[model samples]
Target: MASWVILVGRISDVDHSATPHKIITNRDYLAHPALFRGQRPNVINLSNNYGYQSRGYYASLLASSRGHRVIPTVETMIDLSERKLYENALPELEQALNRCRKELGGEIPSRLTVFFGIAPSKASDRFARLLFDWFRAPALEVAIRDEKGWASIRKIGFLPLARMSEAEKERFVACLGTYTSREWRDSRTRTQARYSFATLVDPNEELPPSAISSLRHWARVAEKMGVEVEPITKKDLARLANYDALFIRETTAISNHTYRFARRAQQEGMPVIDDPLSMIRCTNKVYLNELMTLNKVPVPPTVMIAGPADLEIAAQTLGFPLVLKIPDSSFSRGVKKASSPAELKALATQWLADSDLLIAQKFLPTEYDWRIGVLGGEPLFSVHYLMAKKHWQIVNHERGGKPVEGGFKSFTLAGTPQHVIDVAVRAARCIGDGLYGVDLKETAEGVYVIEVNDNPNLDHGCEDAGEKDVVWQRLTQWFIDRLERQGR
Candidate 1:
């Protein structure tokens, strides 16, 4: 875990002085990184140094550059701090201004929202936007501009302060008050953090190996690197804000709890995996095919099956041994290999009922399909999933439609063919830098992208086999790097 350092110009706050953290003078904080040690500590700026003009500003800029998580991040300071604080509550301020304008007979100059670092020489102070979130404004300042270029300022009287719950008040107070609460400490770090992993587990369903031994291994490796790891469940949504970052271990879907968690975590400014957009883009094959074809990525000859007539066009265009798949199908669940018109009709008729459209592809048979795991825009690992015995797909699920995966072979990143890696990166790039699995088929003619999936499996021994614990460590490392970019 990262350490804590309190920065103050004076030790006047007795409650703050009691913390065991190392203390540094505000002047020393403004000094460059070369003057300090290398560890990145979490800092509390008690000097109340704020704004672009303050020494505390330079200190924060320097601290963040050195990887420290300084409170009142430059972003928070610029976007939500003093002087500009009232502007942060633009909606309420605008409403107050409009009300003043209406009271003054529709004159635009009748009202305004203003801020000053010092006590105002005119008008009056009526509202305060607290440093912590949850905004409110009760009144406004009226600016009366006459034919002369000069203007006179008078108060329009702010609205009554918005009533806040006990929790909101306490949260606001604790955030700006003396002692940092244990809960806040758990969720955010003044320094580097031992992050949280959001995952789902169900006994009735089969999960990848990463859920077990790989998960345990992640914790072990995290500890070795001075990082913390915790596995959380879907029920922990309310508690998610207490963690440093979110890594979704469950399969992601745009409409599911996983998407909700990612969206919420993102709103709170925490780094997240399988970000909401990635889930939406990667989960739907229709979207993926369109994206790939538009970006000029090589894909099997494909057509959309939106109407009954298109099925005939597909048959004529793609011919026998073609494949038909539902847009959101996974694990070979809604995929079918059609060898005849009757089979295509039965499958397309049944599948089209569930989705508005389907995909038809030229079937490209191979001994196995390559699964390239790409992370942070680079290829991390590769696996070859051999087709199941007497089955056309890697996962044989035709019997009762239950998925049955087959044997897999993992290879080091360096050992995989360059063309495979290059094409994999190209496909993954169509999506963002989020973790992805690019499935491809390597044939004598060339390589063709099968699909790009977010939240690709990181099975303990399989995906990580290429580099041992390095794969998991690299994953956690990305989280750590991204977490540093968030919050103060």
Candidate 2:
């Protein structure tokens, strides 16, 4: 976990003991870079003035350069200072304002104070959160007004601590306490480690690729490799700049926070598994289907459905018992099997409401699927994912949406078939090489690529069964090598 520090232009800008985190003068922090050379801390810039090239602005600027995560980042400061930059955000802000108009009561207040994403009034809590998500600042004062028949955001500006009333200061303190306490991090200390690693996870995920036990074991392995590991969630987005590298353990989607985390890590120049490019290519089956076919990678005969005409073509071409998939299906959630023409049309019409395109492929029934783990364009491990009981998929969700997974058999690289390993590596290379699980179907004819998964499962005793300690060691080294290459 990153150590926290509060930066202020003047000593009196904030109460000395208002927060448990360390407090330091802006000048002292700016003057002494050696004091924080090796460690990256979370710097809350409560500096008094943020004018261009001012002490406050430079504090945030230097914090970012030194790899410390700072609130009211340099970009945020520049965006708020220029009206044009913030004007584009007005529509969303207006929508949020209107939603809370009733709770705000009568005419929307001309102005409201927000401290650390918390509004003084309980009714504006969600609006405050949205504001914080847009502008990461210690405090903000938003101006609301009547635009025709609705509430609109007129202007927004920073709320200086020096200008806050005593009551507002108390509220700020409480909000700061609440904000800093949201992360559910492990308490173990790794002060001696050379680098910091952030493992992004969702504790409440029903079927997270990596279990908590697996994460703990990886943390232990990381410690032995002189790296510190911490489990972070979406709430820690503001703190991402402090880490040297990121490993996403949760399921990923282009429209979700996991993708946001991956993009942020890349922007920070940190090595991240399941990088944004890999997610874009792996998450969408439409893109993968075209990519594989173009690259000469063997895959099932597939048809892309866009309208009723295309549906008819797919039904006639692939025939009965074909699989239909939405672009972003995962864990067998948005995939369905159609055994007849009517079933195909019914399923396609309903699924098309959400997605513009769908994939229809010849159903190649297999007792098991060959999942080959590939790391950095090299084969890592292999597993046979047996089909669920009386089901054709590895995971069956037919019973009330609860998934029942099948058994898995792990194999060493030498033990796995050379043909399977070669095909999996070829498919993974079609997408950028980070970490991938290339799922393939083996029939009497040949092995065909099914799907290339980004952020594949690394659960303890599952993927690691083949190499165990060797797997963990290699994984840790993969991160370290990238960090070294980037001169982190």
Candidate 3:
């Protein structure tokens, strides 16, 4: 797929001669890029007049929500639209100054802030030359009324003055006066970040180097990409400010420091992996089930065993030989298969001791489950994870399970079944366009999503076994693209 522009309205009217790029009109298909669709990430720049009536607003919003890069982003369009509707001019000239001051945080006396929501289209004309004699200086206590003495409330409609003549500059300055207000941000507190990247790794909880040489391999990749990567331990919570972006490599829990790091990094305007929203949505099976079901993503025959009474309902709905899961368990832990009523009761009682709910799913016995590693809504690598020998699950974490091992066979995206690819991508998009490992089961019934895991395993030897180099490159490049787009 080539670079596409979403020219929603009047594609014929749009003169695309200025840039040599493919334009997707209302008639063209907006493709969710396939794995074979080359290197460039799918992008859409919305080129349409945005207002309440224009389809551009909805298009921009949807594109942005799905993590597409949109020009004149949804927020910008709304800001401009609101300017035409909800604006108050403070007596006269460049009336948006007050809003800028507000955006900068209340009032600032020392530092001046100006905003250009929509840049001046045309040039400032001779109308700007006329200025009152009293407005020549920063008049702090002038009347709210203009020189005419009538009530003054002028709209902000100015043109760019980057190439103004000396005479025009003087007149322009005289037309606008400054005012004194309290400082919005302190000068001393604002400092440039010291490092380019900070990987949030818990010494005890990070993926093992055997499964993933992340510390050394990713650091090397970062180096090759000209990114300065540093390991930030749990103790470096305050030092989050020192880095431009964060990558949490630890097991994230909503109640733990990992989630806090993700939240804080997002708040500080850094591109983060396992983004806070993803962490919140993917951490709980209950949330994933509802989200997927609501969105029509194929999920297994499942029921929420929320209370003691629901156990019978689950038994009736799913019948015998079903799986029970605690909402937020990892590494095949807290997941149990109950073949009988007694086993189901025992497992439910054990899991319910912690979480308020349990996820009871009909056991879909298969040789191997499909694990699709989707990043940015496209498959990076996929694997068929086989059950352990003589075990019911890929990983047996039971008290005396056979030496804790899981088998996997990697495959290129093209070699995988289309249903697997389609369902995985569909399931992933329902969750955000972040790095996700969508685990799914392919059965005689249909392809059913097991669960969507955020911060999916990027084990160097396993997940990356197919397109070894591409897997690592894709992950690192995602950060690079995010940082560059953010202008970090």
- Top candidate (lDDT): 2
Worst 10 residues of 3 by lDDT: 132-141
Mind giving the per-residue lDDT tens digits that candidate 3 earns over 1-488? 23344343446533356345455642232223222133332333333344532345444433433344444443334323433321311323334333333444443223121211111111221112111110111111111223332323333221223334455444433332111111111111122343488887766653331232555686777788788888888878777888988877787775567776775676466778888768766876766776687567989888877568888988999998999998777767778889988998888987776665679998998888899999988889989889977888887666473446678899888789998999999989888878898999888889999989887777766777787778877877887787676555
Highest TM-score scorer: 2
As for TM-score, the candidate ahead, 1 or 3, is 1
Residue-level lDDT of model 2, residues 83-128, one tens digit each, is 5546656777778877887887756788988887888888888888
C-alpha lDDT values of all predictions: 0.64, 0.82, 0.60
Model 1, residue 174: displacement in angstroms?
A: 45
Give per-model TM-scores.
0.61, 0.62, 0.60
Question: Where in model 3 is the C-alpha error above 4 Å?
Answer: 1-195, 206-212, 399-403
Question: Candidate 3 versus the native: TM-score?
Answer: 0.60
lDDT of 1 at 154: 32
Give the higher-lDDT candidate: 1 or 2.
Answer: 2
Listed per model in order, the count of residue pairs whose N, CA or C atoms clash below 3 Å is 9, 0, 2
